[model samples]
Target: MGSSPDIVSPSSRIRRALWPGLWVPVVILLAGSALSFSVAKRVSSQTEALAQQHYHLQHQALVHLVLEHLYRHGNDVSLLKVPLAKAMPQHLSLRIDTLERHTKKPLLQLGSIHAPLARQALRSELDIGGHRSMVTTMPDAQLLKAPAQNLRWLVLVSGMALTLLAFVLSLYLCWRNHQQRKLVQSHRKDLKTQSQKIANLNVEKVALRQALNDSENRSRDLINLSGNLIAELDEQGQIGYISALAADIFKQAPSDLDEKPFQQLVVQVDQRRFVECLEAARADQDITQADLALAADDSEQPVPVTLRLKALTDPVRGLVGFRLSAQIKTRPHD
Candidate 1:
């Protein structure tokens, strides 16, 4: 025999089927990533611009100090021609050199973000190599351009695209797996139904076997009672079945009373008494007795019989019937 097909679980199949069409979130991720990088770049630009402005102010202050000293000793210093060697303090000179060094690289970086013209103005003012120049020297348009622009767009686009693609792919797979899971569940349901049907069939077979056994016992009861009279009555109170022993008792063959009412054959000397016993038995669900005198056309004398009536309830029609058994009475003689 050939090998069976590998069964795919319902969950797995569903994920597979639904793993497509997840592109929108990818776009959102791209936008968010780009925005984050842009924010960082803008913040950096603001900090650098503030530092550059502060340094310019400090340089202007130092120059003002030098000019004030020159005005106060302009004549004496001009005669001596001693340059205002002590005009700017040593600490201020050192601070200016440090600020210039720290700011020059930032000016070049800012030039990439701002327009070329503005970037150049910033660079010329900050790029004071060795001489610590604080004011703008030459305005180069390129220096006005902004920095980190390339990295911003690159990071934003790339991050968003990657995140979005991953999200969509994951969702699609989940959907497909869900579908597969449902399919597997359906198969399991079918298998359960089949198992239940098999159980039901087994139960029915057992019931049938038990019924056959009960029938055998009923047949045995019938055989042992062959010498005794038995009769079955119908819904209409007609005698429907008579055993062979009935023929000997009634002085007629069992077949003679078929479809005939037993009341016709029995002489009712006390009809009221017979009906009273029957009604009492029905109402109380107890046994009631009545004596009957029956005679056949061929018999010379009447037969004394003690009638015992028991109730039978029909399942389908809810009708009540009676099982009547009779025994011929024998009298004692000296």
Candidate 2:
């Protein structure tokens, strides 16, 4: 029987994918580091190597000059050595390990060598060979590597600048996040303040409505307590509101007379008096009096009443309406 293939779990596959993806960035970072290191090493090598030709030519010139000086001195070795050692460049160390042809003496060594010296770019030998061999060696390292040091300083400065730039970006993002939070908090506070104000205004509106209702009820009670008929009229001399006693005097339901003309309740002969009383109230008279006969539609005889009218004026609109109080009069004599 064939073995079944292994089934990978969903979570295992997801974890595998994520872990491998993480390595992509890691590999890129490693590549970048390796590239930087390679470039730095290349810069150092180039700095050391660029001037090799120049140094070689300079070395050849010095050798030729030394030979020329010796020939001019007629091969007097002691006379030639003193001035040559004094005229040598301060930055270089020169050594000649050779024997003279006839005297068999070892040649001169110039410049001090306190440390072990391994780096030497050029080595040569004089034609004073066969019996005596002359060797010359020069190290071309000291001031030639100054360019490499300057390159190192440039790398360090660039790294420091990039680090400072990253630090400043982090601070700016943090400050921006902080400012956004503060702005959100400010908006929330403003909304809360607006909501509180709206709630207070609603409370005030309810209080005003309750106060108006109370005042109307108090006025109704005062009129009922006076044992008289009272009616409130609009600017058109229409009954806007009336006491319950008005139903008894008008011989009709208060609802029936509501918004109906006041002239409808007066006798035909005295209906002119209704117009006169309304006009007097609109004229800003304090209190006006009239004698009128009140008769409803089905009444056979009219009842005589003394009607007193008062103006209801508004500051901006002048006279808006009137208030009428009626008292029924008894028959004077038999």
Candidate 3:
């Protein structure tokens, strides 16, 4: 039988066999890529968080550094000794400059918080006229402002790039996994089809063998039926089969006399004449009949039998078996 195209195709078999190895690695690669992307996003988030935290700490430190600088310069300026309580214009100017210098690029980029509070605190300490006068005194204020502004843009750009890279990696992994899943599905379908075909072939093989065996059994039964009989021949030229009816009259089983030469099994039967008739029947492809008497092996009386013999041919074996039937003659004296 010709196999279906799919079954005979090499590419289809290779697809089935390669699925496990090929697809597993693709799945692993997709998973790894996804995990790495997740980690990168987290790390980028952490970087932004750390940048914010650094801004908070630096803001506090800048305030404290300005306060300390003012205290140390107490003798140089009139309001320095009472700088926290008095309107010290010089100290306000120094504090702003200190803040500008102390804050790093990242802290500056994060920008200031509590701006209103810082100004209020400064106003509370200094007179409004002093604050106005000192605003122009801090050169570092402009220096801090420029770097801080630039740092914000730098951090934002870096974060955006990191986030974009993560998203790209995630998309790549997702697409890779989709391809692998499709391949695996194809392999599974192929395996299912092959398994079904194998099951059908197995069933067909079993059915054929069973049919062959049944035919042989019937033939054997027919052969056995044809061969199960005994025959006899007499001096007048006759040939015949021993029959079940004869065996019953003689009080013996029919099988015991089967296949025995007529002369050997039937005494008072002419052996030569019977052999001649058997051969003639075989040659002519015909049947013959006889009337004879045969002594039971252990008895003196001769039992009369009418016999019939039919030549048989076995087409399969190209040989002959014989068909025989007989009936015994009942006498009043028996």
Q: Highest lDDT among the candidates is held by which one?
A: 2
Candidate 2 wrong stretches, greater than 4 Å? 1-146, 186-211, 330-334
lDDT of 3 by residue, 1-334 (tens): 9787555577877764543344444555556556555555565566556644544444444445434544566423343334332332212233332122343322111122322224223211222323211211122223333344455556555555655565566656666666788878899999999999999999998998999899877755664465433444332223333544445345566566544455554554555554665666677778877776655636446666665666776777543555655455744144
Question: Residues 247-279, candidate 2, lDDT per residue (tens digit)?
Answer: 666567888888998888888999998789888
Decreasing lDDT order of the candidates: 2, 1, 3
TM-score of each: 0.41, 0.54, 0.32
Residue 306 miss distance in model 3 (angstroms): 3.0
Highest TM-score scorer: 2
The RMSD of every model to the true structure, in order and in angstroms, is 12.6, 11.5, 15.2
Q: Which stretches of candidate 1 lie over 4 Å from their true place?
A: 1-200, 203-210, 216-220, 223-226, 230-262, 268-273, 294-303, 312-319, 330-334
Off by over 4 Å in 3: 1-30, 36-259, 297-300, 329-332
Against the true structure, candidate 1 reaches a TM-score of 0.41
- Winner on lDDT (1 vs 2): 2
Q: Is candidate 1 or candidate 3 better by lDDT?
A: 1
lDDT of each: 0.54, 0.68, 0.49
Q: What is the lDDT of candidate 3?
A: 0.49
lDDT (C-alpha) at residue 224 in model 3: 45
